[model samples]
Target: MRRFVIGDIHGGLKGLQQVLNRCNLKEEDKVIFLGDYVDGWSESEKVIDYLITLNGNQNCVFLRGNHDDLLLNYLKTNQFNKEWFQHGGESTIEAYQKVDSKTIQNHIEFLESLQDYYIDEANRLFIHAGFTNLKGVEFEYFKPLFYWDRTLWECALALNLNLNRDSVYYPNRLKLYQEIYIGHTPVTRIGITIPHNIANVWNLDTGAAFKGPLTILDIDSKEFWQSDPLHTLYPNERGRN
Candidate 1:
């Protein structure tokens, strides 16, 4: 069975579906989502619903991203925090306008059920965002770091260039996993629009939340696919500012 890992979806159901369609998946294929499933686009609730349906048909691992966490927290405590709202969270709120409470709750439960990180048998680590502590993979870093930190990506960018497998010069987090796949820090920020590899850590977030497309990669084969950029798909919609 082909094992596929996808980057941030960001409520762009079209992007999500497009990437999946390109995967040529079978019943036994495994799909791992790196999170940020909600926010940015106009179908956050629909995106979550589709994911719930996919769970029954495939081996799916859902990891929570910062946007997914914001929605969950808002649903649980009734606090729609301003910061979250400012950052594509409003689209998620809008997406729930006509959605039934039960379905919304199911979506909430799905979000709550998401894992922080997943490590496969091959030791390939899947995390929404890389950890903050460059010192090591130890849990000394805060939880938010796992969902939001860009330091690991930055470190990977540097270490990968030097080709330094040396533990002393490179960060310890690099050595902890055989290979790392992460989302959250969109590749668009670097002015590139495709998945990028730095050392063993691959950044799959092609920025579906902004102008880049959603990306899916085969862990074993290294084959990859991408949806049209969200802007191209949505046309007039202003995806994640």
Candidate 2:
């Protein structure tokens, strides 16, 4: 089975489907999403719905991003907060309002159940952002650890030029997993760098939500596919806001 890791989707269902179609995703293939499944686009709810369906029938794994974090907090309290509304959270709110309350709750639960990091059979690490401690820390324990806070990563960026090293989060000599695949900070204008490295970690945000393209990377084969949404119909004003 081919293992694939994708960058942040950011609720662009059309972009997501386009990338998947280009890849010719198969039932046996394992796919890992780098998170930020909602916000920025018009189909936040649809994206979540599609993933929920995919999770039931396929080997699809979802990682939580900062956007997903805001969504989870908003859902549990049934209230909209500043951080949620500020960062394209308003778009998600609009999408969620279209669906019934029960559906919204179910979708939120599905988001909550997602793992912060997904390690492939080869031990390639995948997270929404990047990891802090690679040895014993779970992404769920410190939710923000999955996406933000790059103090240690910045240090690693200065030290590792060939992209080989231990966990930068801690001071121990613990060896980290193979390679880390992450989204959140973009590279490609539409789909920035396929393997953009900042702190010995690869970032694949690709900016699909903005002027960039959606990206899909075949982990085992190192092949890549990208699709641009700007070529299609212009997004609505909501997508811009």
Candidate 3:
């Protein structure tokens, strides 16, 4: 069984399919998604539909992301206007509008059910963003989990400002997790850099919603596979067809 982790899809259905094809995934293989499955592109409805079909399959695990959280909020209160519009949620709203009410509800349920973070028996962890080292905290705050980044979290820890933060701080250091696979921050390529004073985390967000490659990481072997997102997409036509 091949075990793999895919980075943020962000409405790039074509890129998603290409990465899956490149991986040669089989029924026995296990696949995990790091979130941000919607927004940025015009095909969020399609992505949700695809995920719906994958339900009940033991080979897949989809964790909640900040964008996914906004999507659910929109569904429930119809008031995710600001955050959604700011972060490429306009395209997602259009996609959802085209789908039926029932389908929209189902998709919302799926997004709401997603876990904030995932921890495996291998001591490896997967989260859309890093935590603030909050001790005894069973959950993470909403915005930072989706927006604020490493530097901010590290600074917050350094000054001992966040009284809620639980974990120990390593001065000019980053080793919070045994192994952490994260997305939410886009990079030019799959970042494997782990300097002495740097973090032991791997960032797989290859900017599928923009110009870079869409990446997938093999969990057990630590191998990588990627595909370009540009060639497969059409030029933006102002959200119209």
> Which candidate achieves the best TM-score against the true structure?
1
Q: RMSD in angstroms, all models?
A: 1.5, 3.5, 5.6
Residue pairs whose backbone atoms clash in candidate 2: 187-192, 188-191, 188-192, 188-193, 189-212, 190-212, 190-213, 191-206, 191-213, 192-206
Q: Mind giving the per-residue lDDT tens digits that candidate 1 earns over 57-172?
A: 89999998999899898777768978889899998888787888899789878988999888899888899997866554456458877788888888877674655577467677
**Model 1 residue pairs with clashes:** none
TM-scores for candidates 1 onward, in order: 0.95, 0.84, 0.80
Q: Write down the lDDT that model 3 would get.
A: 0.68
Candidate 1 global lDDT: 0.87
Task: Quantify all predictions' global Cα lDDT against the true fold.
Answer: 0.87, 0.72, 0.68
Where does candidate 3 stray beyond 4 Å? 134-176, 189-198, 237-241
User: Best candidate, lDDT-wise?
Assistant: 1
